[model samples]
Target: MTKSKTFWAASALISLALMVFAGYSIYGRVALHFSGDTIEVKPVPLPAAEEQEEEKVDTKSALEKIKAAEKEDKEEEAKAGRGTPAKTEVPRMRAVKTAFEYKDSAAKSVLISGSFTSWKDKKMTKKDGVWKTDIYILPGTYPYHYTVDGKKKLAPGKPKAPTGDSLVTVN
Candidate 1:
């Protein structure tokens, strides 16, 4: 090949390779950001059986204290001739079927947790490179996130929560 043609071809190849490398780098960064690599997960140990029993006893005592206080309030109201307070009906909130999804083809397990689940991890089913779960939730906003392979990850494109987690709203 002519020196000029050979030089031109080499330059073109180099340019193409540079472009490919830049494109791959950008893709990797975007993927890592959306995949929740920035979020950290810390495992909390469960309470022991003895501690659970103690908590039950404490709950019983707390309930008894509340009942006693209510009785005292009623007695005082009776003495003041206020009679019994009329019961007001509180409207019940209907639960909406909400779907949560996380995409991670490499993940072996995915779980979702939030105020709705009492912060307990709920397992998600995987299908076609997506992990998903449906939960019946009352109409409200709740902070939540996904646990992919035991690491906390927020759902991509979702709003951020005050606690630095992802937010989900059910209506």
Candidate 2:
């Protein structure tokens, strides 16, 4: 009888856990449905039949004015080089491929932060004790640095920083 009671208690606990999980899933689905963009519509009763007739009369007058303006637009398009290509020229921008590398054997995380990346920390992956990452940026000069293990520093043999940041130029 003691063994049967133990078995029944275990079964009850498992059943309660399953019920709680199912209830949580249902609550999450209901919360998600109401959380995102929702449109609520309350039915507004239409105007009386006599008031609706007045609206129809005003619409008929407005329709005539719209049709007359459309006819004028058709006439202007016929004279405005309708089938010819437009003479406007669009300016083009090019993207440049650049590689930023840092050689640190003991650093836990190496990041490349620059103007192209909005000066944000972009973590680089380590390979054979050297951290490297490639970035595609626009053709321009950008000043940047390598943040190694939470310290802001530059790579070896870099030029002196007037802006306290090393420059990388892309042409």
Candidate 3:
């Protein structure tokens, strides 16, 4: 009878120990999951109005200095030129009527792009299955191509340069 009582008591104590260990593990896991076991707080300072004003003053002074330096450089250039207008005159640009034609009847849209147009999409109009557009090009060599339905096509009878674009000379 004594041996049986001791065995029952030992089993109850072991079971209680395992239950306590499992409860502690669950509590630790939940605490770490919710708040990561620590709280971090930081304080941020607000900017002062006087500090901002000082920064503005510094910026203004720097701009004034730059303006003064530019004025001095212009005066020096004027003195070197001996009281005459700056050399070299800008060439007068003229509007030249240019035309392009795409003979493909299957094309849905056509565009003319060149250096004057900044290589942007300039949509052309279709007339009797021919795509045409008039561009006012300056007197220079421009590399251009045609975009027919989102496909790049070089101008007909114009060979592509090493830069992979057909050249056009406006005089």
Best by lDDT: 1
| Deviation from native of the Cα of residue 124 in model 2, angstroms | 0.1
Give one digit per residue, the lDDT tens place, for model 1 in 1-171: 699999999999999999999999888755744654333333345767998899999999998998798788888888999968556476898999999888889999999988678678999999999998999987877778898888999989998864668877666
Off by over 4 Å in 1: 1-91
lDDT score for residue 55 of model 2: 90
Residue by residue across 1-171, what tens digits does model 2's lDDT show? 999999999999999999999999888755633454321222345766977899998999898897787667776777785764334365788888888889889999999987678667898999999899999987766667899888999767755344467777676
Residue 131 error for model 1, in Å?
0.5
- Taken over the whole model, the C-alpha lDDT of each candidate is 0.82, 0.76, 0.75
Model 2 compared with the native: what TM-score? Answer: 0.48
- Tens-digit lDDT track of model 3 for 11-79: 999999999999998887556435422221222357769989899999999989987987787788788
Name the candidate, 2 or 3, with the larger TM-score value: 2
Comparing candidate 1 with candidate 2, which one achieves the higher lDDT?
1
Deviation of model 2 at 39, angstroms? 46
Q: How many clashing residue pairs, candidate 2?
A: 0
* lDDT sort, best first: 1, 2, 3
Clash number for model 3?
Answer: 0
